[model samples]
Target: MVNLMRYRAEAVYREVSDAGPGSGVTGREADERYSPIDILHDIGASVVFMGDVAEQLLGDSPVWDRVGVVRYPTRRSFIEMQQREDFREKHLHKEAGMAETIVAGCLPIDPPAGHLGEVAWDDVEYPPSDGDGPLMVIHVLRFAEGDAEADMAAYQTAAFAVASAHGARISGWFGVEGTIIGDGRRWDQVRFNLFPSRAAFMSVLADPSRLEAQRAHREVSIADTYTLLVRPAVDSLAASIQSA
Candidate 1:
């Protein structure tokens, strides 16, 4: 069996109403109980990306508050962490804070080369017209029950060119393995992409050439998929944590 690294991407929707600071116990309080960074670090897990969900592009899915991707050194490391008592204790906070969530595990396969370092949000360029903030798109996909390999190849060849033309860069890509936690949702692949703005992204989607290319590969290869637009929450989170 081929040993592959594991990654989990979570879509988190936090409780809407905030409980008072003095509230003995509440979902908000649970969320504030502890940060999982230290534990994740001790267990050799790295956060690939973490941010606030900015927009919903597909169905009328409930709004998500945050989206994050975590990388584990090994699949065993992931399993071991979950089995640890301390880890379980900390997880209560996550559950308390979350109104709804989806977590999916994936195997890193042919992730874009050279984009694997700690991301520098400052270096990310944004269109002058888009005053909202830097935007990122997360794609969750499942392949059809056919020649998945060939379908992927055909889709990628056409998609890459269109992506580049629209000034979108792929930050991360992985093949879905199975669920490690949360709802038992399955996927075949997941991708993170950065775009200048929503308009820029729409341009890519509306491109005649790109649409034409999709018919030849993407349409046939993908059985189901969903995408989310998000804003980087790392910088703000880091600032708050440091100040605290």
Candidate 2:
């Protein structure tokens, strides 16, 4: 699941059945208290990555504070965990602190192959970030009304080509199955690009190939999108997934 959270300035415990963060507390601090690790353990789920937003690269969506990617053993396990009394008690903090949240159940969807012949994704060497460290650029996208899929595929193919050249990888490319938490707005996909450094990501923007792809496919395909850059405390979700 990919979580996009927008926290309130002050936590508000409204009609919550359980005790949680009270007044005068900032939402971020309050939410910090909402850990239900025991429930997660029981369900065999784990947090893959969690981080604070470093910057917004694109989008008209309201600014969000935090991002999370969680892996679950099964969807049923997730639902059962949510219903557990212990988890519900702790959930009050999230309920009180969150102004809005969007939790998208995701499944990996690799970008189309064959474009980068003889250069497989696995063969690409990903080096540790230099300077301030690696950053993940996340994109939440909603496709346009007509012929969007074809256009997006072409765009992703072209975009991936440019991204790979800049030492970036598609860390998580997901198709949103459903929205567990949302405010009516819907999304089609969520893509993540892990870059070695801020400097490298900046270079991706200046690449002429990226511009050509945007004009040729991206602009026509995506109707709405949010592109966020974040420095995750857990740098590599792929490592965790692979080990699991």
Candidate 3:
């Protein structure tokens, strides 16, 4: 799941749960206390990545505080976990800490190798080191009707030329399965882009090739999108989610 969180300024403990501090605790801290490692292990799931939002590079969605991706062995395991008393008990911490969240089921895939000529989208065979220090740009997308792939292919062909100039690459590209939690907005895909650094990402702001592609192809293909820049805390998604 791709989790975009907006934390409450102060944690609000529900009446039924008395597990966390009632005062002077930030929502993020309270959420940290909500970890259910054992419950996850029982279902053969794991958190593949977690990061704080560095900035909102594109789109008009509400600013997010943190982003995380969790993997489940199966969707049924997730539902079953929710029904467990222990899981429900721990969920209170997340409830108290979060003011809003967008939880989208994300399935990782190799980026369309055809469009990206030399950009490294091959995490399945060779995953990059976190030490490469790329900024993770999360793209949440909703495609428009008919022949979206052709337009996207054209867009990627142009956009990636500019992207390659900045030493950028694809970390992971996901097809959004469904929304687990959100404001009922439908999404098509979520793409993870990795730029060498914040400066490198910013430098491509006015690249003519990218702008032309955006104008000619990308803009017309997607009805909605959000491009987020995140600073990763931990990331094993590239290696783990390919099989997941």
Query: Candidate 3 lDDT, tens digit per residue, 1-244?
Result: 7898999898888673464435667889878988888899988998888999978877776788999988898888988899999998888889889988999987777686643325453432223445545578889899999878899889988877777766676778888889999989999898887766666676665787788888998888988888888988888877785565
The reply for model 2, stretches above 4 Å from the true place, is: 15-23, 114-130, 240-244
**Model-by-model lDDT, in order?**
0.61, 0.79, 0.79
Candidate 2 vs. true structure, TM-score: 0.87
For model 1, name the residue pairs that clash: none
Candidate 1 stretches greater than 4 Å from native? 1-21, 24-29, 32-34, 59-63, 111-133, 235-244
Give the root-mean-square deviation of each candidate in angstroms: 7.9, 3.4, 4.2
Summed backbone clashes in each candidate are: 0, 0, 0
Q: Candidate 2's residue-wise lDDT over 26-141, tens digit each?
A: 78877888866667877888888888999987875678889998888888888888788889878888887899899999887765663332344334444444455777899999
Q: Top model by TM-score, which number?
A: 2
**Which is the better candidate, 1 or 3, if ranked by lDDT?**
3
The alpha-carbon deviation from the true structure for residue 36 of candidate 1, after best TM-score superposition, in angstroms, is 1.2
TM-scores of the models, in the given order?
Answer: 0.71, 0.87, 0.87
Question: How high a TM-score does candidate 1 get?
Answer: 0.71
